[model samples]
Target: MYNLGGSVYWNRKTFKKWFATRPINLKWMLLVILVFPMFAATWEMKKSSGFSPLQLLGLLVFAFAFMSIISKKTKAPNLFFLFYVFLFLLITNLLLVFFYEGSFSQFGDTIRTILPFLLFFYFRKHLNSVIDIEGFLITFLIASVFPISTLYYEILFNPIREVYNTASRGGGLRLSGFYADLFGYMSHLICGFICYCYFYIKYSKRKSKHFIFSNVGFLFVLLICLIGIYNLRHQASWAVSLILLSMFVYFIRKQVSAFQLFVFFIIALGVGGYFYTQIFETLFAKDIAVYEGGAKETAALNGRVYLWKKYYAFWENFNVLGQWIGAGFAQHEKSSVMMSGGMHNDYVRFFFSTGIIGILCYVSFLIYLIKKTLKTRIVEFKFLLLASVIVILMYSISALPLLASGALMYFVVAIASQINKNIV
Candidate 1:
């Protein structure tokens, strides 16, 4: 009974210090845990009785973030602009949902779309240094090896032959890995590979043994990703990757000689030309045909142009304020277009779902993020932010990268904001 309470208090203080100072890259590990399972969530959704692995992981991350805030271990950023834009969008969407008698799913989906921004802030708080960012990227690259390996095995062995029978379809082999489909797999791969390239460029000259190992590991991961991209036969991913590579070259031009630049350009052009030729021969070489009604058709743009036209036609029915929320979801199902997926364009999707206000909010958000990036003092971080923005913009033209797993784009912006604030 002699000072028992004092002893317990001292023990608690010691524990907190140990927790705070513990090494082993806890923040990087947390980011990896948060993101890596997303690749496997689609597959796990079928096997699980309730929430999928991805959802559980999200809840866990959220719990940790909430506790951190409560304990004062980390403070949330003063994201007044972002908070205002998000709140406005949410209020408008809620009003629309009420007026249109939208389903709960519609309201929930809207919330889900914006939820990533919250997670982005959580990550931004933890990723407080360049080393933290680098560690996170490396962890992601390592975690990616599992999915990539599974994709290769499935392609080569076809363990589930019935499930993969569609690989020989007209568009060539499409390896979905553990994702819902090939497109989902491509999205993750594209973003992860771009981050790997950024890290490689920034750390290639470091003399640290750990960095040397990281470089070699990243090279292997890059090779696997390249092969996966080829097998997936996604033109959008290919185009984005080519654009990012070119940007990387331009980014490093000052560091390399003129002759080096020329050689790099020549190699890039040669490789790109060869890849384009193969894509044309293998994926787009369908025979032209004329219907009995004298209609000529070719497999141009993989029918994306026709899909865009149909969505545009549907957009005509919406008023200036839009049909409220869930317009894209509701209309896509009712329309007789027979499209295989959601609206391929994010801008069009937003206009239909949230109307002009939605579009304005989105544009303003981009402008703000870009302005912040421009003000960043770190050159590597600035280039990474700009490259990511360009890639996301390019991706938005052909696909909706602002929703679903595409929320990762906001994660990049959040990181940029943290860097600008001198928090990282």
Candidate 2:
């Protein structure tokens, strides 16, 4: 019920009909909002530790887009319940940081992740009715070129051209380009791999293009992205990229027979097994410490297990209250547990930083996305969701993608565009 002009209104339908008109076509502003994420590396490169133009743009875009969703232009506003839930959790966690470890820098870092979702409601509000999101989708792929180009250029100056490293990535010295961190580098590489793979699958089904030019172009792009990840020697990214490609094979349904697809998967698994055993296993067979897992040694997994063990010990030592919320995200300033080069795992990061409940909330949000996405009928959306799951799961296992919300952001756009389509 709403109180309008001191008069009580009861019927919801009547209120909406009498309230306001739906807004007209808002051209695809998503292309603009995407720029916020595309510049993440450049933003990091600034290292100003102050307000950045990119951040200012993110705030303005999110606030304006949010206001639009809450206002007259929006369709059934309830369609965005998930986004609201996520936003609430993130904002609340931002406050939690202050209570336990009030570090403005940590606050800034948290907000950077949150800002990616600011325009999510816009996708939820307007995109459901509009079909053929290809134009919009291409922008995301194009945005990847920035990271790919910058990272590749960085490789030129590093004097390391080898594809695989043996020491800390084959000891070949994997560089992060403008991203400046292996985790961040892996995040973008995964994103680019998925983007290129999506196009490869999409264009593969396009019957008109010749096999040579069309397939070769897509293959070149996808292969280049894969090479970047391999060069970085990020094991999880390498693993996820293979899984993502396997899914791509399954999704490219029109052109290939079931038998052919099965052969593809077999080849993929065989290659992956061989690579893991030969390259990854041999390089890191021995470590400072060994753990029990089907596939892990301290060094083979790049000491992620060690870091997670450290975080786990810290969490075990926490008080009951601390266990629930962890000790907050500013561990560098507040915690007695100390380590160098930062924690590689995000789940562990969430646990040690936010606590048990915090990690659940973070995971639950992704589960919600997967659930919602499962109901989407669009094939393209399915690909996006699948690729997202692959990268996010891989990242959570082996790296901190605190700033890698681009996939989730695009996933929102893909899912939101399907809402009206699902309404019958």
Candidate 3:
């Protein structure tokens, strides 16, 4: 404590020293800063074209991350080669922008897409220990509470007008929360649910009463997350959530007693059965009706099938090398002149924008990461990485998870990379 004008206070320098000395504090601070944009959504920012406060905060975090990487004298991990491939892809895209006469919008989009990968390397370089990773995850869980609260608040008191429109149009009200779109909101929830399951499993391994209570609390949070996903009414998100939860249970089944597993199955089945009707209605009925009505009927998948057909036909016009430069947003908008939305499929979008070479590079990078992750001794981290990869791959079939929620994707990758480094 230090005296300031006759008042006692915790000295700023003392606090700074304490924070810097503890690795966990630094990890938590980094994670909170990385996740800050998710919770700082505002109406004015949404309506305006300028950068939001959170984006500015993100830039500051990036600056801090760059400085940290430069100041540290640690050796680079073996996995650093992945960054070379990413940089190559970035350079290829930049070349396309230059050679293809791509607009500023295209250049901007490319930068946004690559920024998260750059940040991931910075995070992997800094968060080196198991305790640091755990602390970062806990900080992520804490940060998640803000968006979850906002989601429920919108559900309870401030339903957007589009909610009524969806109901009127014979569909569910898609929860957008503070996000600009439902997909972004659902992606954030997916990350939160994963963290909750991870912590629940971590605590359940301990036999102490406190750990048991914490496990029960985390279970409650998991249920709450399920409800939140259901409220979003996104079929892909629901499926991914169920898949991740199942993976978690299966992973921990060996650690639990037979009776405990039986009880869990019973609870899951009862809850699932209760929600079966709504789930079926939300996931299948609309699509089934559209299919039965033939070509005259409104296409299901929110016109995704139609958009894919159009984009695929357009893509055929390009040679085997495909469009070297990304088909800028302007081109996408022009292609969707008659339609209301985008291609929705990331593979299609990637092929159209970056061509077959980009796809090969991207797939190779994922395979490399998966191979590395599987070789790690940290079973829990491996399970989390594999589960996240599966969900992200599935999600990419319908939405561009990398382009839309790349930061979260890289956050998961960074954690896995650090875990693997620790093993070596």
Give the number of the best model, judged by lDDT. 3
Tens-digit per-residue lDDT, 66-157, candidate 1: 45545546565565364466446544554444345465544445454454545555566666755456545545554555565677787678
lDDT of 3 by residue, 1-424 (tens): 3434432222346444433566642555455544664645552483576656655554565566667667777765666454466456545654554445556544445454555555666776776655556555655655666677778787788865355325312476776756666654565578767765665555455564243235456467667778887777776776677777677768668766687677666766665675576565556555666777743343666667776776667655644444453343223344222111156665665555555565566666678767876786655676766766776577777776655653355445555445357533
Give the runs in model 1 whose Cα sits over 4 Å from its true position: 1-35, 38-44, 47-51, 59-83, 94-104, 155-170, 204-222, 257-263, 280-301, 304-315, 323-341, 374-377, 406-419
- Candidate 1 matches the true fold with a TM-score of 0.71
Q: List residue ranges in candidate 3 displaced over 4 A.
A: 1-39, 43-46, 58-72, 80-87, 98-104, 160-170, 183-188, 209-218, 271-276, 290-300, 323-342
Q: What lDDT does model 1 reach?
A: 0.54
TM-score of 3: 0.79
Clashes of each: 0, 8, 0
lDDT score, candidate 3, position 38:
64
* Model 2 steric clash total: 8
Ranking of all candidate structures by their lDDT, best first:
3, 1, 2
Report, for every candidate in turn, its global Cα lDDT versus the true structure: 0.54, 0.54, 0.59
Instruction: Output the worst ten-in-a-row residue range by lDDT, candidate 3.
Output: 332-341
Ranking by TM-score: 3, 1, 2
Q: Total clashes, candidate 1?
A: 0
